[model samples]
Target: MKTKFKIIIGLLFFSLTTFAQKDQVKILKKIYAKEIITDADLVDYKKNATKYGDVAIEEEDKVYSEFYKSILPILEINALGANVTTMQKANFINMETISDLSSGLNGTLDFEKKTGKKLYTDKINETIRNFKPIFWEYVVVLDGQKKYKEVSQAAYLIYQLDKKDLERLYIAAEYALRAKEYDKSIQYYNELNALKYTGESTTYIAKSKVNDEYNAFSSLAERDIAVKIGTHTDPKIEKTPSRTGSIYKNIVESYIAKNDIPGAKKAIVDARLTNPDDTSLILTEANLYLKTEDFDTYKKLITEVLAKNPNDADLFFNLGVISSKSKDGQAEAEKNYLKAIQIDPKYRNAYINLAVLKLEGETKLLDQMNKLGTSPADSKKYDVLKAKREGLYKSALPYLEKAEELFTGDADIKSTLLNVYNALDMTEKAKALKAKK
Candidate 1:
């Protein structure tokens, strides 16, 4: 009889577990079916406020917040085991919310245009704020389940809903990049580039002033004077969005990450085609050539760019680098380095290179001095050579000191500066630098 009772107990426990799972699944489905807040819903809430009073109206207005809350349980359920049907249902819910919010935001914007009043601004902003957190939660859930394609899709939806939201666009592009969906990432980055040029315009409506009529009837003929004061008649002004240049850089990087050098080149070309006069894009193209080791192309491109904008310090610095790398370019390198420093006094790289060039010259002079014999006549010659070498070393002092001041934590710079200090007989400064590390 005891054995029979144990069997019955086990069967009851199994039945309870099965029923619990079914109930959880039912809740998940119900959450998915919850209606998303729409423009019409907002309108209804406003229209019915008088009939419903403040409490009922407030409850009705919590539709979006409530919907987001409803999905949390399903997200929790999916985190454990993640039933396929439940996951699909959650994605559907996300898609629906994205679509509804996007449509509602557009409609609200249109209403503002017509009414000249920001009626739904706060509501839309609140909904977006609520949606963003929950949207990220869904992304985490999908990403944890290794549903990368779904994650990208959700990210793309968020971007479409608010193209002006650069953070969302960047997240979408990064997700696509991580999934090896290079084409998708490129598309998103291109969209970002397009939207970057079309900046948001803000409009403000000014209130009109009222006029009062004053009459004096003391004389035979009464005269009425109309006075208008504190009236605002200024027209609404719209400010265009500022142009941003980093999107092209992002696109090029995405292409390079996929080992598509030609694609990166083409992206720069396309950006230039649109923004021919954009110096930043031209500089980006120059950098692309430099990265690929096409020195000739980089030089030619930068030369053309410099002709247009010669005051650019970075361009002068790049020219200095190119000159420094050439076979017989000491003089040219020095000229370019000096030019860069003249344009920007705080140019640390220019200072470092100038100092290194002087140091190299001093080192060669020292080598020649060391090669001299130890005879009395040779000793006299060595003294002259050593004096010349010391002068050359001293020439590097100002630049090296400036470089050290500009960048304190660089070990290479500090080491080079220490060498310079020792060569110039500045023992105190060298000891101080050595004590730092």
Candidate 2:
């Protein structure tokens, strides 16, 4: 009697567990079968679906489910077109999740157009009416896929939706730049500048496990909780610097591209005032002077930078490049180039430029040789010039060889070295280089 009672209790428990599983499945199926034609219907269905167990619809289904819910409101709005407010449109616009609708919406419109059930323009208007959060979310998704033009369009739409959201204009400027809409980018940037917008924000970050680099969290509380829970390490609250300098710098660059030198100069001065200690602003000013052939000012500004950053090899290289542009400045050019090399022994560009400086006289000598007539005097002169040319080749050889050794993968260096080798009749070296090629 005791054994039978125990068996009966075990079977009853098993039957109850099996019945509960079956009931959950039945509830999930019933929820899926209901036609969710309105947002209210969806809300009811979601409540029922989650009542018995935690059930998530497929991601694609969730997207289309939201689309199905929008249909009734969209049709009603079209029927009662004049009665709707922009706020109503904005609300519905933010209701639908349209990210993963790669082809469904367009296909539906095409079908409607073909059947004459709905005009194409009406469908387009409906889409435009319900365009906000769709466009907003798509901007992020499109940016991730590197679809710059689409991102630009979406960002512009968001800007249209809320002109008061200056951050949207900022984002529009960025995507416009990426999409190569330079004029549009400049327009947006200028507007931000007029508004005196300095885009600065504080971010909560912690070091990531994969790269050990700081990854930002959505909020300070989240970051602190993650750190406290030992999920992330190296918690930090970082304040982003202002974008005023960069905004002005971008304006200056666009102006330079347009060859509006005066505009660039004016913007660069403002940029420097915005960030007085920015080294890049100083460089920009120097480059502007270099562009206008004001070498005196270029050298003075560069000297100022070198005084502050005496160990910078690239600064010395810039001085060398500037001096080498003039015939009388070759000596100074060589001295600065050598100084750059002394600071950074592996400076490939300095080596290449030094070789180039040594070879500069070859062109003049060749010109003089070509102009000479084929007389006995010309022949004697030719021999002297030939000897000088050979000496020039010898002078440049060491620097070229060193540059080649340092940057074997550099095509410019390889081409220059090959030409020098052939000119000097370095048969074995030329052959070796050809074999490598």
Candidate 3:
């Protein structure tokens, strides 16, 4: 009967030991395998390394071992990660000597477990503090070269970051890019861009597009790959951070690139905060509106600048360009061009433009002959001026004839001069221009 009682006691002890090990193991495995963790994990991972005040060598060993067992594989991973980072490496290496501590703990635990010693609660607590299994998962996945690892790391990093860390998200993007997970990197980059954290919005968007192009180009090889993927057109991105006084500038550039002149102007108007004393922004705003044929904003902004500075050649030029672009542009275009000439007589474009305008009507080419006055006559010049002043050879022939004096041997001008003669109702001159060649 006594022997039977002792056998029961031994069996009960064995069962208790088995249950204890299994319970701890199950707890960890469940937390790890499911890959879901609680806030407590984050809190513990952030727990201080200097928690035990003046710990003895044996106590420190006990503490390290306990942390290793309870933390699963996360603590060492973080230390390595922190160490690998900028300047964090120097501090991390000198901070606590992680490798030795971890090894000592594991070795001590193995020894203790073999001898059937009681498991300490402090280690479990430390492990609980050292939460962040993604850290370990990252190492494992990277070490094993798992395809999903980089994307997974990026997602976790994004989740872990708060407001202050939006910029650091670039690191996660690097991993995602390296993994060929272009979409995920874009997500992070786009998020950062949206936060207005750094650089121009279009800048980041441009970078993203470059990455997309590289990726698409790498995957395919065809002459029309750009046209095929429509990769030539950049995908739109949300507004991002801006440089001081450059928000509107950036938006304008983005619109130009997208070929949305009207949209670009609208963005400028919407975000139009300009220097108070300077109406340059107003002039810019007007020019953009004029490009879109939005006459109201164009007149309003340009007029405002002109009112401030009447002699403003830029505003006059702006008005001239707008006038010329209008449907009934002839009259207003002539008026603005003259005004520009009056303001800056030496404005080279005004002289050239006036020369052009005279030939548009039934005016003589010699009317504004003084503008092209005396360029040692060349067919190249004649041809260039001829093409530029099309539809009015009556006013252009004299200049062409005069210019042909120097470049009589030039085939291009000689050919154009013949056409000018035909328009000028001078059949004899046309014949003469052709006959010379």
Candidate 4:
């Protein structure tokens, strides 16, 4: 008889517990169905539902997750507009709209974590998957707009979602550099270096039937599919060169921009060890030495570079530029500039610079001429200096004219040529240049 009474009590407890669980599910369903559900509301519901034990909490979480999943589309439509394109065709969206949608999705993710259920897993995953490429498209548009900070943000989003694509991280770093966010750029670049991302790949391309233009596909499979379809033809594969050298080069440049000379020196040393064959890296080192006023080392490095790349006219011209910085470097500057002109006969800037270098010699003569008195000896000296000045102008005239001939569109060349002509008393040429202006 006592055992029978104990069985009766257990049955009563089971019935009451079942009733409470059902009651919790019912109440939470009403709460989740409200016109506006907040985080606090969800928290309160979860707390109340947990009082009825695991079964009640599971039912509430399942219901609440489903409710969130259903409302997500509405939130997206509202944030993105009713006419928003499909995921594949996502275009420029302002940050406000993106933030709104991101907030909703993040909240859903949070909800899933708190609930410990797999109720809406697939849908949320699909949405996140779509977000990566959409953010890439946004990055492209933002970069064109020179909204570099936004580009960094969008690229970082892509990186977070798909860390395997180091290109996205690289894009983030580059844009961060452009945005002058040095620390962020350094951090991203460090991550890339640690990952040893070489940025080498094969690109599959096909000619589009619609525009007769070549379009690159994301993958070989996609390219093959496009080729199998009638919309594309003449598929080809192109190998993209590794950007390893440039990555290190930019890191050094960022360090230099931050005025951290020692850091720059260390970075350049490390970078050269990684990519010694990259002449651009050598040029960067030469530039760093130039910045630190280590002229001997700068010239030595540049000369070394010129030996390896003898046919590079720009290197010769750059050497000329470096030499031109000192009062004693005229002959060296003139020699380098002449060598540059010889290599590229139509090198317009070299001609202009050589002319400027020649014209620079007149400064001392003019200074002496300006300090002269009206005495006969001073007058004689003045005449000699004046004649020398005319001779200098005469010598510079050919280069100025050649520069103007090579490129008729450069304002600096035109301005310099006009001044030279005026100084040399070449009235007809001066008037003609003025008329053109």
TM-score of every candidate relative to the true structure: 0.54, 0.62, 0.32, 0.74
Off by over 4 Å in 1: 1-133, 136-154, 160-167, 174-183, 191-244, 361-388, 404-415, 426-437
Best-first order by TM-score = 4, 2, 1, 3
List of clashing residue pairs for candidate 3:
44-129, 45-129, 65-105, 66-123, 71-127, 196-241, 365-395
lDDT pick, better of 2 and 3: 2
Scored by lDDT, model 1 comes in at 0.67
Q: How would you encode candidate 4's per-residue C-alpha lDDT over 1-437 as one tens digit per residue?
A: 99999999999987887787677656665664465655566666656545534543454544444444333333333344345675524433455445544554555566767877665556656666755566567677788899999988777766664567788899999999999888788788888999999888899999999999999999999999999978899999999888877887788888888998998899999999988888889999999998899988999999989889998889899889989997799899999999999999998889988998888868898899999999999999999999999888888998988888888878999998888888888899899998874
Best by lDDT: 4
At residue 384, what lDDT does model 4 achieve?
Answer: 97
Report the lDDT tens digits of candidate 2 across residue range 72-150.
3344333334565655554433212332222335444545666666633364445655654545655666788898766
Per-prediction backbone clash count = 0, 0, 7, 0
lDDT of 3 by residue, 1-437 (tens): 99999999999987775564445444434443344455565344333222221231355344443543434334433434333453333232211233333444455455556666646434533542453233334334443665554544534343342235443354455455556555555465545546654554432122124455422222223324554565554422345544423434444544655567766666566556434444655655666766677886787788888888999875776677667766778678767777886887656555445545555644443334435645566545655555544546555554455446755676765766676666656788777767785
Query: Candidate 2, after superposition: displacement of residue 243 in Å?
Result: 3.2
Question: TM-score: which candidate is best?
Answer: 4
Least accurate 10 contiguous residues by lDDT in model 4 = 69-78
lDDT of 3: 0.52
